[model samples]
Target: MPRFFKQPFFAWFSPSPSRLQRRQLRQAIAHIIGDQPSNLDVYQLAVRHTSAAKETKIKGFRESNERLEYLGDAVLGMVIAEYLFKKYPFKDEGFLTEIRSRIVNRESLNGISRKIGLDHLIEYDGQRGRLMPARTSMYGDALEALVGAVYLDKGFNFTRRFILKNLLSHYDLDSIISNNTNFKSRLIEWAQREGKELRFEIISENGSSQYREFIAQLLVNDEPFATGSGYSKKKAEQSAAEKAFEKLELQ
Candidate 1:
């Protein structure tokens, strides 16, 4: 057995009272996933954020959900791509790609994770004074880690079923397809159709290097149509475009 699996802290036969907590955690995870996990430690690690991680002697590096997140990201993309290909056989690649992006975006994933109650189960070091404010993306990252754990414990097919039955079932695909919110693209298309110039300008930047805020302005024919702020230039532009799209009734 691996050192981590042999550790008394995770040993299934440990006589410590923590054994009860571990059992309870396993049950909770089984309930959430609708299937029993063979390697409970992997799932436990999935919910653990880097802020609460501890270094291991074997790896000399902290163990957290990041690695699982990367794996799950690729798995999720593949599953989603396969699903879109099957669902929309006639749809062009651009449409499929755009829809996939919208579905897998950070905000969408965060919302889905929250809806599935994954946010409540996440373990992070919130008490650390130096830790940055909890980001919504953490919940999404944890959710991805959970997917990776599921894939490892169960398999790819089971992971796909979990995503389709538990996660995607909660979303209305018809509504999502009908109500595309690529405001920036829509605004640009509208501008091109009307033979008007459209541009985005970064008006200001503020905050620390780690968490800088950007303000963006959307201009139509050199006239400012709307202004918005976000954590990144792309986000700010998207917000500005959204506001402009709504105000101008472009859609």
Candidate 2:
């Protein structure tokens, strides 16, 4: 039996067992993964904490999730790219890129992470009680690290299966196509059908280099439709266009 079964277990003790003790725990993860996870080190690397994880480095190097996060990001991109290619055979490169971006975006990754109880796997010294909702990067990054681990341990086929089973299973193809198409592309398509002129322009810039900001204005038929701001020029344009689209009630 595991030491966790020895009684008087700490509430803060690992939610997932240590690597050596994961035969049973990982079995469930395996079913979730559709394969046995052989790289305990890689898994550990995913959930490890770094000084950058917080403001200080009270723990050692192995504690940080950086290395595993790097690996996981690559693995995730590869699997998602492959999936998009197969799923959208007739789609152009730009169209496929849009869908892939939506699937692997931070929001989607975080959603999937929560489903896997990834928060339970992270070990941190920060005050759990006072932590705000926004400081949950560990959960998102850990998911990516897990992907990296899966790729390194089991190879691409297993990783692809895991992605298809757990993550891609939830997305609707048509919905993704409708929602994730670029604002510019979608707007142009609508305009072409309606025979109207549309334009986008950068309005202003704000903030410093470390945190630059952009404001964009959208024009429909040479009149201002909407304005929005974001961390980048492109994002501002997208936001402005989305607002304009909403205002026009054009899907």
Candidate 3:
């Protein structure tokens, strides 16, 4: 069993887990992550959704998994890129890129996060409609945040191993390769075919240079249709396109 009440942030601001709750949280973290965490507070923050930022709000600063999500997004991209690069030594750049996108894309991660039961552990505001949409990305974002937490607590090498063992195992690389999901291209083509204007606008960009985050809104005939977020402009657009494509029922 892992130690409890290990960090001040969690003990003070966030929901104060009881002795039993702390024990349960520690056990849950170990069980879900397959390793005990050194800092319990960070892990708690990882599952914290943006809507509940105010609840765990620090007096002088903002608190949410958003920053960690950005870090994890970058980490995930790099680690997965390296994995695909080495795994497909003979494959072309486009092939590897597409496969990697398929793996890290919002939809794929959402499914994986839900399947892994990360949704249940997330501390979010259910009352907030947009924050908890019907088909929510909250769980997926939490997963990325959780990855960030792992990276912070255990470092890169351990995080890499954890991803390979826990996350990549849920995926079939061959199947991902077989599927052709170029949402951006498809959406552009649809716009051209239907004679409708399509644009992906970067509405916001925030965070430090190391882990900058992008939020994109998809426009159809100059109207906002869907929005998505990622660590890069291209990634944000890709995420936006995916959401728009699904919204349009193009699939």
For all the candidates, what are their Cα RMSDs to the real structure? 11.3, 9.9, 9.3
Candidate 3 — which residues are off by over 4 angstroms?
Answer: 1-14, 54-60, 182-243, 246-251
Query: All candidates' TM-scores?
Result: 0.68, 0.61, 0.69
TM-score of 2: 0.61
Select the stronger candidate by lDDT from 2 and 3.
Answer: 3
User: Tens digits of per-residue lDDT for model 1 on 187-212?
Assistant: 88888989999999999999999999
lDDT of 3 by residue, 142-247 (tens): 8999999999999999999988889999998887777657789988999999999988899999999999999999989889999999999998999999888877
Each candidate's clash count = 0, 5, 0
lDDT of 2 by residue, 95-207 (tens): 77777877776666766776765555555545434533344455677788788778888888878888888767876767867665467688888889999898889989998
As a whole number from 0 to 100, the lDDT of residue 154 in candidate 2 is 86
List residue ranges in candidate 1 displaced over 4 A.
1-17, 129-135, 180-251
List where candidate 2 sits over 4 angstroms from the true fold.
1-28, 51-63, 128-135, 180-201, 204-236, 239-251
Evaluate residue 149 in candidate 3 and report its C-alpha lDDT on the 0 to 100 scale.
Answer: 94
Q: How far is 97's C-alpha from truth in model 3 (Å)?
A: 1.7
Worst 10 residues of 2 by lDDT: 1-10
lDDT of 2 at 5: 30
